[model samples]
Target: MSVFLAIVLLSLNVGRSGGAIKPVVTFTPNWGNILYLDDVTLTCDVPSTAPEEPRTYHWYKDKRPIPGDQQTLHIIESLGRDSGDYQCQTIGGDISDPVFLNVTERYVLLQRLPSLIYEGDPLTLRCHHHRFCKAINPKFYKDDQEIKPSGSDSTFHIPNITRSQSGRYKCTKQIQPCYTPNVQELSDESFISVKELFSPPEIKVPPSRVIEGDEMTVRCDTRLDPLRGGTKLHFAFYKDGWTVRGYDVSDTYRVPSSQLEDSGKYTCEVRTRSDTVRKRSDGLYIQIYELFSSPQIKVPPSRVIEGGEMMVRCDTRRDPLRGGTELHFAFYRDGRTVRGYDVSDTYRVPSSQLEDSGKYTCAVRMTSDTVRKMSDGIYIQIYELFSPLKIKVTPSRVIERDEMTVRCDTRLDPLRGGTELHFAFYRDGRTVRGYDVSDTYRVPSSQLENSGNYTCEVRTRSDTVRKRSDGLYIQIYELFSPPEIKVTPSRVIKGGEMTVRCDTRLDPLRGGTVLHFAFYRDGRTVRGYDVSDTYRVPSSQPEDSGNYTCEVRMRSDSVRKMSDELYIQIHELFSPPEIKVTPSRVIEGDEMTVRCDTRLDPLRGGTELHFAFCRDGRTVRGYNVSDTYRVPSSQLEDSGNYTCEVRTASDTVRKMSDGLYIQIHDYKMQNIIRLGISGFVLSAAVCFIYFHNKW
Candidate 1:
């Protein structure tokens, strides 16, 4: 037997309208009761579905009207008279349950919020005392174990509360009063129980019985606390104790086509993203019934003879409940399709031959093609009129422009030597020559693509006693290798020449073949096909640097190859210049200096550079060898945006610095101070002489 703890629920007095959801009332500083002069705040919490605008709130105490109409009721100085049952109501919404508040004048007390506590909620334990008594070095304990001790803070707080924190809690502290000795005091123990944030998840499915070939969906359902509606939750689905769907925000798992093997015990799980609280639903058994049974192949002939007609049928039984459903059938021989799906279950072979002698099977499927099954195979042997054929290739190692020939070889029965036979040639399962009296296939000029697995078929003029030859492999070598891209002077600098070449080697035997080349940069065509194999940039700039590739192709484009990309980076001659001031802070009457800073590549060490200074976009000093500009006497008008420019001797690589603001201060204050000091020195000297003479 198990005993459950009871939660103190707030009883409702009035029924809510269908359009309204009940609101909740909560408080801050979570102390159930506090001493006189302590602060407490009460709030009205509504569901997220509420309109996103300000609303009017009505308050009541112990079934009586209160003075506040706002969402929150704040009490700065709590008094004994303020203790009562608090309730709130919002306009167009239901009235909230009532919460009790107790105010006492006790010397010391440990209190928690009077509202319900749920997992993931924050908990605060306050050790309160009378206003006149000062609490010092308060200590908190849970189940006789010291959790917090020797602290000046009057409260112990847990940011995220868990169910494991449930226990009896108390606080002890030293209290000191004016003109009285300090005394130790202990608070009454209060039990705390953290309720679940959400109920356990349960699996849900369609009410109808599940059947094979039908679509099915399973859902994991759980109810979360209304106050924590914004909390994130994850759901997962499982079958036969194995995971079917990993955790995701979606709570549903759908099966597009349910099968008999899908029938098993299924369960679903739900958890918060943090895995702090997890729950699994109870197992649910699901049964899927088949719509039809497996099919069987029926052959009429006990022994198949050459040139004789034969027929094969696929048989299957549908569920009695689905008697009106239509099914399709197909037939196969030696794992090769002989007949495609059709409403008729029978497959007819106009004339049985030795080539048709092999394992045979059949299949049945519904019109929707969702439910399908195959039948066991059966073997049928046909009397042969000729030995199996074999294909022989001439010049097994062939190159481009080489003449190739394939011949079908077979031996006919001596008694049937006069029978007329037709031959057909196939390459890679595609017909290359139709049935005719010829037994050889000839290619005047063989290329790389002409090489493949070749086979030949032989049959009598009436189309019976057919036989096929084994595959023969033919090889043809390429006329040229793939092209490659090469860059001239790979490491290029800005304002330098660059060239890209497409290179390839042609076979000595095919040296007379003509080839054209094209150039591309960053996948865009820069030059069309031409006899030249190189692309040149006389004066390459930074923009010319990119991924370059080239293509080589024959006159008819029958053979084309693109070279691998080559990345080219252009190095700058020098970095951009920056303006710097000698004294970051400038004032009137002070000499100010500005310098242009830039760095040139070591390779260009002897390059000459010139600098110029500007104020407000207008050049103040012409370009010169010196990088610095000096102002002998600064004035307030010097305060403006200043910039500098650096350029090469040829003025080809020019760069400018961003603007810098310089401000100058007034010089009148310094002059006045200097005059006043001189006047005071003269007056003091005259007064000293007059006093000495009088004495």
Candidate 2:
């Protein structure tokens, strides 16, 4: 019975677990506060017991059936207007509990912008609004016209706005309702006026007569109401519709040194935080008549005869005449005022004089009280005739060897104009020289000796005037002749000293006068010395062996002349002391000999005799009695050359002969006997010749 009961209970539990209905669902909130207009779903948990066919869903508000019967109910948008209690009911399941939904609105809030504005200024407008539990879009309106739609917080900014931007503004709220319609609300209007602040000041320039490069003042003054609220003001000046000066200042502006360009319609403009205004007074045209242009004068007949009439005109043109203008004209001659005239046009001068023959000018000046205007000067010249005279020679008589000077002088009208007198010198009916000098002439010395039958001639524009002077003769005296250069020991010795002397010859016709002497070498002056007649060069080196010349110049006015060059040769005696020997090697105790000779001039005769000997540097042993020297036996000490010397009181000559070798051998009877007999025979021959010559 227990087994059977267990099987039966297990079967019943299996049957109950096999097929059973359960509920599954998901919910989404669409509306605020009450969660109305939310989405909901209902599903079956058990697969076997779930409905196999289509099923319908019923929407409910607080467990009551809603008007729409559908599985899902959609709300486009949720708002406060659509807030309510909601539920859902399934066809095969129990109804759900009610859900409370609440709606909220969002809006932007705006505030009033600042009121006053100036031209070229920036401004900002704000539009703000609020909605209960909803997000609202804010929009701005100006003068009942929509300006801009701002999201959330509404703000509109304008940069560089003008007065036209001023208007009445308001903020509007936009509402979007869920499952309903949209709504809009407008706030109270805000007043915004861009008020123009101050008008530009009027400018006045005192003493309107403006001149270039003249200092003047321009003042700006006007009536305007002071601005408020930390406003900065600036003033600007305009001329000819263009801005001339602009600066930030409290009010007034002053300008000095109003240039010619500033002489135009001037207006002042004022700028403030709120307004920019300009005001212009009646234009006062400034006439700037500066004395910039120099005066010019015209002259007729620049050159005129000394007793003729001349006319000069001076005039000036300028503007702005305060009173009747009067000009004072003045005429000048050679930097001096010759005459003056007060006239507007030409001034006539009659009967011009010699004093008026120079450069004559006329100047015109306006009255001092009025604007200063001066006319340029006109230069005039008067003509006059004159001739150069008083021709003479300076230091009239010229000496033959002396210098001379000549000069010509003449008188001329100091004011001669257009007439240039030229001085020409004539010699023997021929023009030798000429000068443009109108007053004086000078001739250098020595050149005046060529003057013969001299005359002074002056050339003028019309005619030539000449004046002759008595013929003058020039006498010239010879000063001194050039010095002659003579050398001592004319035949020079090579590497020997020499001396040179210079002698000057003076003319007895002219008194004996000490003259200056100068020595020269190779056509170049070496030194100058003042002496009576002669000069000497004491010592000379090899380089001094050249053609030497001397010059003598008289202390009087005489030209220096150079003498002919003199050449001298210096020779030296032959110096011979070198001596050399050949076959220098010799055996001891052997007979050897040497010869002595030298390259001395044979004309010197035996005085050039040379002797040679063999010795160490200390002493001589063997010497050459004649041209050839012999020695019986040579020793090792005799290995040196045999030296020969020929010398005189002034010179010496020396030479060395070839070395002589000598060797000694062991004594033999035959050698000894032959040597002995040869020596005996040589001795006997020498004695026989000596004795025979004596007999």
Candidate 3:
């Protein structure tokens, strides 16, 4: 940390040290600017509480490391080479800021002690010349104006220095023997700067925003040069320019329990123990917030209802910073205590009467009663149990197929929040919904007949305090027109695409209402209800020919309509193929032929047809113009089931014929010959075996 601090100070040229104390460099002869061959001593002053002991020191010139390990560096007969910026540091301490020294080889030179001058510091100036010359007389001049009378002494001093005393200064002297061959020796003018002893003090308050009853601490901040560390400083605090604390070594003032009235401008004064250097911080404004706001008497109901339960609440807000603080409340009536302090913020009356009306007030305070506040009185008026009832209808313009709700509106004291109220609805002076705990009557789907003058009555559970609302007239409008089925391409043909659309005219006022459509054929659902208004059949067949109808309705399935049935006939494009066999009874040498017989509709005569033949599920011939398969020679191996298939040239219409069985009869003479051969071979084998045994 010490090494880091030294590096930071040197790199940033920082004036104040934040960590370890920084060493201060002071010259023994004080004046840094001098004539050649002048002897001077530089000392490194470090503040410490430890006993004196051998300590290591480092020195630098012009930011470069130099050779110096002692606390003091003495320059014997300083020469021009000695002129440069000097800095020093000690082990485990911060490095000091650089101080510049100037050396000139002139006949005369003007210098000031304590190269760095500050307000309230003593200052000394010397009119110097070469040692070989003896000065006859010397005088000091500031800003080219004579400041000191001619005298034999070469030194001039000021008891205390101020900023106004800073300017260019030079000295004039008469030497007995001058190297320049001039009688009067004049020193070059040098600039002097007077710096402040300490920066201005600033008032600081942590957690700038403070709440009442919270501890607050105020601080005064200022910086004094380390070179002036020995100077003692005293601090004093003020509020609105009035002294709150007298001079003291401490720079902080604390308040144990802050209050709202304590909010004001605050400032602090810093001065040297000798009362020489004084500085006051600028005024800072501070505001103390209330721990909890003043209590206010609040009645839930605008008008208190007679014979009803009444509840009064003392409402107050606490500072968010002190959210967990507990508070006590009290209630007053006509300047008399109606309820003593309690943790609860409310005062309740089981049954309120007209006599309960009076001026009410509430008081609140913290648990310790360190701060207490009361609200201004409020006058409460009590009246009947309820306000006049009024009827309200949602969506005043009711539409068919829309849900409607009618409510009996009335105001009841909130104190009776749990009290059960019964409500009844009427239509055209006839009761629609009987009295119940509900205050509203709802209609799932309204029709034209439901449109009439509607009214409602509200009453307490015991039938007491009944109020009737004025009648409200409602008119239900048709939501949409009847829907009809629309088929594209008026005439539908087999093997062709067909589309059925449901058509309806929705009321403009009911635009954006979602409707679902469904398609049916022969009284059976062909398509389920969906948002689409059209249903499509990719390819129509004879089976698709039926009494078709479409349905349209609201998403709620309310007010549904079905289109009139329409007869749709799909003209056949082609008939299913059938298998035909020639020479049904097969003989051993008879030739057999199978054919796929199919008839195309006359209306589609231009459509080309292709056929294929299969024997027991195996293709005997691929699709071609020939639809017949022939067996040139009838044999038992060729006696199997055969099938035929036919399709249009585009392969859109395909059909297969039923299987047909064929049986081939083998010649009886051939079978008998095969049996005779087998018997002869067996007989020969037996004869051979007998002959071999005899031999």
lDDT-based ranking, best first? 1, 3, 2
Top candidate, metric TM-score: 1
lDDT of each: 0.82, 0.52, 0.81
- Candidate number with the higher TM-score (1 or 2): 1
lDDT of 2 by residue, 1-695 (tens): 22212222222211122343322222232112222232323221222345676666667655567565565566544556655566665565555434455443434434432122444445555553332325466777889898886676556777656567777877776654444466656454556666554444667766666654456666666544333333455667667777777755745444444344556776666665334443354444456555334456666675565545767665455445533445566666666765655554566777554555555455655555233344444445555544325556545545444445445555555565445555666667677676565444444444324645666566543333334445444344445545677776666544345666676555675565667777778877677656634444443344566778877776662567678988765332334444433345445666665545444433333453435455444335433335555557765555543455443333332334444333333445447788999999999999999999999
What TM-scores do the predictions have?
Answer: 0.48, 0.33, 0.40
How many backbone clashes can be found in candidate 3?
Answer: 0
lDDT of 1 at 368: 90
Q: How far is each candidate from the true structure, as Cα RMSD in Å? A: 46.9, 30.6, 32.0
Give lDDT for model 3: 0.81
Candidate 2: minimum summed lDDT over ten consecutive residues — where?
6-15
Cα misplacement distance, residue 150 of candidate 1 (Å): 4.7
Q: Which parts of model 3 have CA positions greater than 4 angstroms off?
A: 1-26, 41-101, 130-166, 173-185, 196-198, 206-208, 221-234, 247-252, 272-275, 295-325, 330-340, 345-363, 368-370, 374-695
